[model samples]
Target: MSYEMKPLEFISVKFSIGLLLGISCGWLFPIPQELAILLSTICLVITSLFFLFENYRKGIYFGIAAFLSFISLGIVAITLAQPKLSAHHYSRDYNQDNGFWILELREVLKPTNFNRRYIFQVHALNDSARSGLILGSIQKEDKISDLKVDNHLLYYGKVHPISPPLNPYQFAYDSYMESKGVYDQIYLNPENSIQLKTTGKSLKGWAAQIQLHIKKELSSTPLGVKEQGVLRAILLGQRNDLDPEVYRSYKDAGAVHILAVSGLHIGILLLIIRFFLKPLMSSYFGRSTSMIVTLLILWVYALFTGVSPSVVRAVAMFSFITYALYLKRPTSAINILALSFLAILLIQPKFLFQVGFQLSYAAVFTIGWIYPLLIRFWRPRNRFIKRLWKLFAVSLSAQLGVLPLCLYYFHQFPGAFLVSSMLIIPFLGILLGLGILLVLLASLKSLPDSLALVYNQMIRTMNELIGYIASQENFIIRQIPMDRPGLVLLSVIIILLVLSLQKKKFVYLCFLGIAIAGFQVWNLYLLHQNRQKNEVMILHQVASTAILYQNGDVLYVMTNDSMRIKTLVENFELNRRIQSTRSIPVPNSFYLGQDQWILLDSSGILPPVRKNIKGLILTQSPRIHLGRILEQSCPDRIIADGSNYADDIRRWRRSCQIYGIPFYSTAEMGALSLGQL
Candidate 1:
């Protein structure tokens, strides 16, 4: 029994165990039980086949089987230990009042102006009503003074189930939470809530305390609000305080990921460790000690940064690499990454759907596999040039890998990311290093005022440079619609093409190129089909409501409110390419202007008169009377705004009956389109 074979066998067994455990855990959720059973069966079959096919070597097979069995037991134990059924049941039913809930507070999501909002994991909560636990956007307004993590208080509030936002491209808050295994929303009422004190401490609470300490220390530094905020966000994951403009600057510069502690930050930390331990690396024991210390510090930093999935993934992968180095064993970066992924999935399988998780892995995988291959082909002469080229290659590789996922999630791609990353990546490393140094110095009581001043100056200089780069007009940022699945297919094809190039497989490359071209053609066909289809879109409105009707190239908006008109025109691009523009009047207006026809006020109008009308559409309540007028006119069809008809189906039905008209509500019929009569 060879040692190499032992590890290989162990890995195979572990893989089978993981698969079975994952399937079973998934079944505990709302996933089809039959599917889970089938998957489990398949896993068992595969494991059996591996054992049967591989020659039975006593020591090797036994060792491998034992290792696998242990791994499997651990996975199953963890899965069983998880509050899977409770969370799963809670996610489905929203009406519950168990009077208690438990969740890991993840991030202070976004501040709703002066009313701050925080997003955290509701790991588990009690539902007294037994309508399952709800997970969504929990809006709880608190006095700015009393907000802190792990500070449990009893409060009552209405729970609203979080769903996808009304707009297609809008943020899917529900989906985002679902990725974190949250399926309900709680909006805590500020007035009637009484704080029920609980004395408890958590690792997150300690991390929050450390963050607060660091923030206080940073405040004393002579740094501008924006600089300090950016530094804090990069170092401590405290993005709540970041200035909108400063944040935009980083986004525009394609350096937004720098603010989020990730692989880049970990890389910087690793570099610092290497520099500090250069002398100690001479001895085996010294090197081992250095590696352990570095791994511990890195994980501590991850904890301080709230242990976000991205940060955890970065730490886990890097730790594996460090361990491999310490053991004087060659480790494949991709294999380490796969192991990290398996570990994360074992903890929280829901992250498989998170955009952050997807993007993080995609970027790392690209850098690990594609970057080296790219550098091989396009090798530069000068050392500095080569470094710059590698940076460009890294950025390009990441962008290519993540392009489809980004488009699927955000529906927009920053065209300037490549150019921005070139300038931002190296400088970002410098900033993170300096920021960490400042934090360490601030922790020491003997730190001088000059140290603070220097830190402030450096941050200010970095901001200025960032600002200048952002201000450049050449940094093109365009928002392209990413609804076409064919575009995603095209992206996949591009990745395949790039991969094929590494093997010098011209035939595969050619096939990939053809597939890409075919995808583009298919995309164009879909877009043309969409353009041809007559569409009546009822837009989601906050300030005011608007409805759009499109026939061929013609666009007809039935709202006179300028704000609503402007919002629709700006946000949805109602008139992107076509020039045909027309407006229909509200019920009160009498005169027909241009292509716009006004519906006469039916307050005193004769009902028996039948006039040929194209279409009858109701806006708000005042237009309901127009149904009688519409009845008299005998319009082809009737359409009513659903927003105005909230829970008034009986009234709507009565009106439809009286008018003898076929009725359609905008809410029931998502987007209605009427073609030429």
Candidate 2:
């Protein structure tokens, strides 16, 4: 009936303190001078009051409160030290200009498929700008031809502060960059002459050099391009150079995560270290020394790999567990994890909203809590059976943990992930071991080519096995878009029920029911909500135009280019249920001849076949048709794609005024949506 104070209790206390601190910090963001002083004074007074409480429990509570208050004070101090407007906001209304100019050149992050553009984070130099990071996209053709990390010559680019993309179910590139203090977008001008500054070196530069070294070593070996690429990806998180088709095959087969360096990668590294240190761990000095060495090496690896937030989180948790093991002290996985969370949040409170941070923690927590219970039910008879069961449990737990997130952020689930993971995860350990050995051996000039040849063959066999698994017929890739609220609520309820359940069996059942029922309910709700929200989305198209419309069960996409049509169809998964009405010719009657028009009748209202109607919806405005469309349609509303013609704001406004109808453009209003009339 009463609460007891214990080490475990600190977990809850620390979390509560962190949550309060975060809220206070969020409120004090872009802190006003008056507000900062008031809050700091209040915090000091509260800390003083808590310090005065003489009772041990009360004193401990006060001490914790005071400690957090002091932390908050430090945050305020840091905020005041930096330029007030330096922090980037990811809001849609944020301006793209009014910032200092800087140059950035960084490698792109995502896969470069035929339809997809690659996004990159540019490393800026020479400019002493407040926040010197920029996000930009490179066409696949350009990237394939001209971009080689270190050797590429610099080009002049315009740096502008732009808001993040507005797709709710897609990746929040804005939020991701905001966490790392970037809030601007860059547009490169190929023709602009610029001198390349090669004076200074950076961590990114170092990482790029490492990648080049790895590539050179792999080239000299007998491994083919595909195998070499996969090895680089799995070992060093360098998937940029991988073949597009191979990447897609892995993604479609649900084995793409194998290429990403994640917790499983860290676990493999830990196991290799533990395997070699087992004998030494029996002795006192050997145990302490080995633990220290392993921790240091793991952290060094983390840094070498660019210290992605996910990797840092995994390394910290692993280091804590290893230290506990070395000290011969029992450690609660949950408490240790909570402590790690508390530590990370304390350092970078903004990471609380990062997708990778959330997913990594969710996956690890799910494995820690649910995997044991799952294995308990299917008790393995032998060591081999135990290992098999463990693999299954880990795969199931991680997938379940990350499913909702995958749906929310990526809008797709790799259906073959479970079976594919089971097939590949066991060999991942071997891949890491061999990769480490290969790196070590390649460093030694005297190492035998025969040994390198054998290792190269083994790596090639593993890559081929992965390729085969990915090519399976039953492998499915389905898109399931659930917005942010849905994902957050589902995660909260699952975590809550799992933690509160009294028995392990009941906990598993609760999680299963919640997962199934929650997904169905959430999906149905999303479908219903989407039905009511009729809107137009103007996508970024290279050569042609595409527009999407939704009304009830009918969805219409108007596009001229067949490639654009395919892109829209696959991206929206329109073939699943929506009915396609008819393909119409480019409406030459409005303004320009031979101009393409793709129109859909989702609302069941047919367009005027003969007459130049009172209203003309031109998705984009080119020089040819502007005057004619204005003369003919006398359109009630003209909605145009904003990216290309944003510069024509004055003329568009004047035309709209003369016609006495409203004009709206996407650049000013963000993405446009219209209600079903």
Clashes of each: 17, 1
Model 1, range 120-171, lDDT digits (tens) per residue? 4444445432323333233444442445666543445455556565553445
Q: After superposing candidate 1, which stretches have Cα over 4 Å from the reference?
A: 1-42, 45-49, 52-88, 91-107, 113-115, 119-145, 378-381, 411-415, 443-449, 553-677
- The estimated TM-scores of all candidates read 0.78, 0.76
Least accurate 10 contiguous residues by lDDT in model 1: 1-10
lDDT of 1: 0.61
Q: Which candidate gets the maximum TM-score versus the true structure? A: 1
Residue by residue across 166-275, what tens digits does model 2's lDDT show?
32223456656655555555544345424365556566667666666667766777666877777778877777778778887777766777777776788789989988
- Poorly placed runs, candidate 2 (over 4 Å): 1-131, 136-158, 163-172, 188-193, 196-204, 282-284, 443-460, 471-477, 496-525, 532-540, 570-613, 619-633, 639-675
Worst 10 residues of 2 by lDDT: 595-604
The model with the greatest lDDT is 1
